[model samples]
Target: MARGEPVTVEPVVGEPAAVADLGGERALLVADVHAGIEVGLRYERGVELDSRADARRERLCDLIRETDADRLVVLGDLAHRIGAPDGDEREELAALIRAVTDRVPMTLVEGNHDAGVAEAFADELDVIGADGGVLDGTVAACHGHTWPAPALLDADVVCTGHEHPQVRLEDAVGGSRVERAWLRGDLDPAAFTEAGTEADLPDDPPELVVFPAFNERSGGTWVNVEGQSFLAPYLPAALPAADAYLLDGTRLGEYRRV
Candidate 1:
């Protein structure tokens, strides 16, 4: 694929979600869709978090249909719990996948949260890998959790959604704050090593592109926190330095490093 211009970030109203348009044929890139996260949060954490998931699904379907995209690429976290797949959750997710697949081709990339559940529904959907899958020419997609292999970076644009990256803002008095900021930056290999659960990352970080999480309950983490590291190794260097775009429903803002 011919090298396209840099990624364009756009936000959707209602749920305050953002998406990247890759300037490709019939493709809408997305990531970090923890399908059953709400159920799990309620079950385990006892947090009665709520969002219009069904409505979001409908809007997403509408977006796919209206955009006339032939494919929907999910970067990762297709499911919530690791290695746990309840029948009800599986059925609900399967139905959602079927609905979207009915409108456009759906591609699922595995993330840390996706282990047994994602594979279980693979037969009903197209499952891509972290190594990368060629979308058209050089355009490739993967879950940015693991270090992207060399081949992935060769693509014109690589899309992944594992960080669930967000920017935190505070008032002058440091009382009021706002989240839901869109994050866009170059891919760095170093940020992946900082995860507390995992130590060490690949020697070279690929040209990274991180996407915000789709699940509302999966709160976004402040990228600059002391020990709260991101799955993408190069995030620290890429962010607040490289091009970063924050979106609020078609409104885009350039982020200045704090």
Candidate 2:
């Protein structure tokens, strides 16, 4: 957790979630909870799911407790829709935020699915731009739909969640299963220079950490295949030699989306 040294990143105990312990500031980070996802499925995908709002809240609370984190940083897509949230989404998000904030402070990094989220939780939590936030001068975190702030790219490590990175593995029996996973690699320092982002570039580029979707019910892109797309504009180049890991910290080795 020293400056310019790799920060220790790991999944929360007994959860498909992760947290970064940045010496002075500890953060429990999760992404794409997508509250009211059941509603989105009901309308768009023709599937109905019983409201699991309480269950989602409980799961997050449990992770917070397990990690003993001082703060919770949701990477984005806290709600399901792209525009305004519906009554169901609002209620669900409000309940979850209230429950978590009641125990510890929370910070939300805006994402593509978070257009109206700032207003929804304006009074309860701190909302930051999608570009990202710097943590304790060591870690920079963002939602990863676009380019991160230059200052963030210069941090010791940069964490993102918009990819909801996952991997598909096939067994000898001709069966396959998908598991939520983490992607870690170094960013290409030239990307910042080429993009003209105004910041002091590090001698060695910071590492990039892509988180998995916190909600298991959500979908993810297979990251080990050819031409697989990602939401982050600087990715695939920013992280040319990324390695994939399961939520339990199982190393799946190097992967390429293209």
Candidate 3:
């Protein structure tokens, strides 16, 4: 019911979502909404396509209802545009934010793509700074485009998105497929301490959970594929022994080996 309280997280069985207990508030955790990506594709790649904003909003609203979440905690990337929103992106965000907040209060831990987003939608939702948001004092959530704030290192668990992790699985006949995945591991203190972070390292570091992108359109790093690399600066080093799991709850052991 308050900060410094206990918290727990459980990934939804087959969806890129989690039901988190931030003390007394139940929250549905998702990341990388990337609204109006259609506009981005059309302009950048000349790949015209219809917008899926309606479906995206409905899917998110349904998740909130299904999970009975009191709040919607988006780890980051609520907007697709790299800078200030305009045109279709603004329209899309307005509708999405209104729909979600109408169902449940929302928190936006601003992601890299969310430049000027908070200033644009300041009144519609709660905006946490780029350093990340601390919930229940025991859990931290950040968009993993940068090092987590020094203060977040103290939580029992730190949840992040922006890696948008995916894995390439090969079958016996040389067939292959890519699937979104969840990555988790114990935090490695060296990544921060050695990097000259300001916070004192915890004696035993907390768990680090890298969530998959909620937007399937946002292609991700092929973690198990050769030549692919992680986007986060502290990844692999910070989570040297991270394990990967498919959205269906299939554990594939070590991510690099999977």
Task: Give lDDT tens digits, candidate 3, residues 144-165.
Answer: 8877788787788889999999
The C-alpha local distance difference test score for the whole of candidate 1 amounts to: 0.61
Model 3, position 253, has a per-residue lDDT of 98
**lDDT tens per residue, model 2, 116-136:** 889867899888898888876
Model 3 bad stretches (over 4 Å): 1-7
For all candidates, the clash counts are 13, 1, 0
Better of 1 and 3 by TM-score: 3
lDDT of 1 by residue, 181-229 (tens): 4555455444433345343333433344556676666777665445666
lDDT (Cα, 0-100) at 57 in candidate 2: 98
How does model 2 score by TM-score?
0.92
Instruction: Please give the distance, in angstroms, between residue 47's alpha carbon in candidate 3 and its true position after superposition.
Output: 1.2
Best by lDDT: 3
Off by over 4 Å in 1: 1-24, 188-207, 224-227, 237-240, 249-258
Task: Return the candidate ranking by lDDT, descending.
Answer: 3, 2, 1
Alpha carbon lDDT of each predicted model:
0.61, 0.81, 0.88
Show pairs that collide, candidate 2: 227-258
